[model samples]
Target: MLAACRGFVFDLDGCVWQGEVLSPGAGEVLTALHRAGRRIAFLTNNSRATGPAIRAKLHRLGLAFAEHALTPLEIIGSVVAERFGRSRVLVIGAPELTAAVRAGGHDIVDVAAFRTATVVVVGNDFELTYERLAAAARAAAAGAPLVTPNVDPRLPIEGGDFLPGSGAIVAAVATAAGVRPVVVGKPESPLFRMALRRLGLEPAEAAMVGDSLESDVAGGRAVGMRTVLYAPGAPPAPGAADLVVRSFVELARAAGVG
Candidate 1:
């Protein structure tokens, strides 16, 4: 399936590794693909890190790609800037995401000043607190549009455990504010559109490989790209992927790599 494609998009966390450690065969398969002259883009919804930081992590794990990695922060931040130009924003996310927003020329305001915010962005905040939630909810309720990077409820970490992702925080704010957030990550068309633009390929000409059924598989399929679900030791959840593989070695072989 991969051999026919000119471009590839990979999800970073579970597909490449689980927290800094490269997955078995990940480096080899990726290196093989790179040698094959296929355009590759790493798409990640984790707003906790910036694109350069993610690229550095990939380098540390011995994987390199020519294209700059795309993250939700860049996509969403661009949208926010274009739509609201230098407006005050209430950000409840990681420091990396906050920095990204600030770099986009938006003013990051304190929760107490939520009334002045033009948009409210929610991401993974390990230090979430009730006070922050209340402030975000109040702002959203008062007409500030709620924006979330992704709606992933949980994120996989090392040791095979999962932790609450940005979705959890978004859900809380949504519930309190009585408004749904605009999700800008995978399973949404904006991020996929941006990726397709970067790859210079139509959706049908590319393949998306990732471990998550919802964000990766479903999102890829939604964008009309072929999807490959990498679910090790798990049976294919009917119609999940065009091809399901257990390991990157199998994926490499499927892609016509030795």
Candidate 2:
């Protein structure tokens, strides 16, 4: 399959590494694929870190990829910049999400503390509040696009309980405002388009490797690319992946990387 494909894209959270713990054989498979001269990209919906921070983590893990290989924040930044340039944004998400908004040259204002905002961007904020939710609802009612980073209802923590992800907030605000926000994450957004542009390959020639069936495999299928489900502890959903493996080493072998 590696010989048949020009590039590979992976989902980071569950596919590559779960939190600080690396998935089994992730590094080895990535190394082998790199040596095989296949282009690799990490296409993640995680809004918790900037691309630089993620790249740093991958580097520490000895994973090889170029600077332009990451497509999460940069893709989001471009989307926000294109739609809401210089507009005041009510940000209710992680610090990384806020940074992405700011890096796109938009203004971040406190939700309850905001007055003159044209848009409200929602991601996962551990410190989410009813007051902030109310404020976001007000902005959405006033015709601002309720932009969500990813619509994952629950995000898995490392060996712990799941937290309500951006999808939760989107649902709450949409319920209060009577409109669904525009979700910009895997399987829906321009992330794959950005990936294709970065990889310089057609969608049919690319493969997506991820653990989550909802985000990674679904995203790949949405764009007509081949999908590989890499489960460390999680398994593939029925009919979700073209292939399923427990470790990246198996994924590599299946891809003909060895």
* TM-scores vs. true structure, each candidate: 0.94, 0.88
RMSD of each: 1.6, 2.4
Across 1-258, the per-residue lDDT of candidate 2 in tens digits comes to: 545887898787766776777777888888788888888887777767666777888888777564444645666666877877777888878888888888888877877556677778888888888898899888888888788778878776667457777788889988888888776787684887788778888888989888778788888888888888876666656566888888777887788875
lDDT of 1 by residue, 199-253 (tens): 8999999999999888998899998999999987676767779999899998988
lDDT agreement with native, every candidate: 0.86, 0.77
Q: What is the alpha-carbon lDDT for the whole of candidate 1?
A: 0.86
Residue 237's lDDT within candidate 2 is: 63
- The numbered model that scores best in TM-score is 1
Candidate 2 is scored at a TM of 0.88
Candidate 2: list runs displaced more than 4 Å.
Answer: 64-71, 84-86, 113-115, 232-238
Report the Cα lDDT for residue 99, model 2.
84
